[model samples]
Target: MASRRHGDYWQHVLDLVFLIGVTFKAIDGLGEILIGIPLLFITPAGVTNAVHHLTARELAEDPHDLIANLLVHGVNHLAGSDLRLLGIYFLVHGIVKAAIVIAIIIGAIRVYPWAIGALTALTIFQIVELALHPTISVALLTVLDIIIIALTWREWREHRSLRDTARETWRWLRPAPARS
Candidate 1:
C-alpha cells in the first residue's frame, strides 16, 4: 500500500509538470504568433524604430536597462531578409507547437511518439543555440525544454502501457469463435 501510494504521488507530480509545460508552450506559441505576424508586415527599419520607440521611455528612465538596450541592439542588427526569415521561422514553429499541444490535450495517444520526436528536435535546436550564444535566458529555456522532454517521454510511455493493458484486457474478455 505504501509503495502504491508513492507511485500515485509521483504520477500526480508528473501530471502537474506535464500540465505546466504544456501551458507554457501554448503561451509561447501564442506569443510567437503575435510577434511573427507583425514582423511579416513590418520592414526592418520599421521594426527597429518600433523597438526604439517602445523602449525609449524605459531607456530614458534607466540608461543602462539591459533588456531595452539588448532589444535595441538586436533590432538594429537585423536586415530585411533576416527579419522575414525569422518571422517565418517563428510562425511555423508556433503553428507546430500549437498543433502538438492540441493533439496531446485531445488524448491522441498515436500522436504522442510524434510529439516526442518533434519536441526532442526542438530541444536539440535549443541546445545548439545555447552552444552558439550562451545567454542566461536561453540557458534557462534550454533547461526547461529538457525537463519538458523528460516529462513528455514519461507521459508517452505511461500512456502506451495503459493502452496496451486495455487492449490485452479487451482481448481476454472477448468471446472466442465457436469451434467449427
Candidate 2:
C-alpha cells in the first residue's frame, strides 16, 4: 500500500509536468500563428516601419535597449520573399503543432507514435538551425523539446502498461470451458 501511494504521487507529479509542457507548447503555437498572420499580410518595409514605430519610445527611453535594437535590425534586413516564406513556415508549423496537441489531449493512443515522430523531426531541424545560428533561445528550445519528448515517451509507456494490465485482468476473469 505504501509503495502504491508513492507511485501514485510520482505519477501525479509527472502528469502535472506533462500538462504544463503541453500548455506552453499550445501557447507557443498560438503565438506563431499570430506572428505569421501579420507577416503574410504586411510587406517587408511595412514590418520594418512597424517595428521601428513600436520600438521608438523604448529606444528613446534607453538608447541601448538590446531587444528594440535587435528587432529593428532583424526586420530591416528581411526581403519580401523572405518574409513570405517565413510566414508560411510559421503558419504550417503552428497548425500542425496545435493539431497534434489536440489529438494527444483527446487520449488518442495511436497518435502518440506520430506525435513523437513529428516532434523528433522538428527537433532535428531545430538542431540543424542551431548549428547554423547558435542562438541561446534556439538552444533552450532544443533542450525543452528533448525534455518534452522524454516525458511524452513516459506517458506512452504508462498508458500501454495500463492497457496490458486490463487485458490480462479480463482474461483471468473470463470463465473456463468444461470438457464433456
Candidate 3:
C-alpha cells in the first residue's frame, strides 16, 4: 500500500511538472505579445527621433542642398497610418501563441496524444525562429528554449513509456475469473 502511495505521488509530480512547463510556455508567449504591442508604437518614434538627431548633426557639418536627405527612413517605415494594422497583426500573433500554449496544457492534462504532437511541432518552430533571429537577447532566449524543449521531450517520452508499460503489466496481472 505504501509503495502504491509512493507511485501515485510520483505520477502526480510528473503531471504537475508537465502542467508547469505548459504554463510557463503560455506566460512566455503572452509576455512577448505584450512587449511587441508597445514596440510597434514606440519603435518608430524612437527610430525617427534618432535619425532626426543624426541628420541634424550632418546638417550642422554642411547644410548643402540635402534637406531631402533628412527624410528619416525609420519614421517612413513605421508611418502612423500603419500603426493600427501592425498592432492588429502583433495582437493576433500573440493570441495564437498563447492559444497554442493553452491547448498544450489542456492536452497534457487530458493525456491527449495530438496535443503533445502539436506542442512538439510548435516547440520546433520556436527554436527555428530563435535561431534565425539576429538579436543577442533572442539568441540567449533561443538557447533557453532549446534546453526546455530537450527536457520536456525527455520527460514526455519517459512518462509515455512508463504509462504504457504499467498498463501492460496491469493487464497481465489481472487473474482470469473462474468459470462456474
Q: Each prediction's Cα lDDT score?
A: 0.76, 0.76, 0.56
lDDT per residue as tens, model 1, 8-86: 5455555566677888988988888887887787898898889999999999999999999999999989888988888
**Prediction-by-prediction clash tally:** 0, 0, 0
Candidate 3: what lDDT? 0.56
TM-score of 3: 0.41
The residue-level lDDT of candidate 1 at 91 comes to 90
Give the per-residue lDDT of model 3 (tens digit) for 1-180: 112233465455544454455566678779858856875666567757766777876767776625526365435677665665666655665676577556544445334344445545655665676668555555665565554455456545554433443444354446778999
Please tell me which predicted candidate would have the highest TM-score against the true structure.
2
> What is the alpha-carbon RMSD of candidate 3 to the true structure?
14.0
Per-model TM values vs. the true structure: 0.81, 0.82, 0.41
Which residue runs does candidate 3 get wrong by more than 4 Å?
Answer: 1-24, 36-43, 46-93, 107-133, 160-180
Residue 43 displacement in candidate 1 (angstroms): 0.8
Q: Please rank every candidate by TM-score, starting with the best.
A: 2, 1, 3
Regions more than 4 Å wrong, model 1: 1-7, 160-180
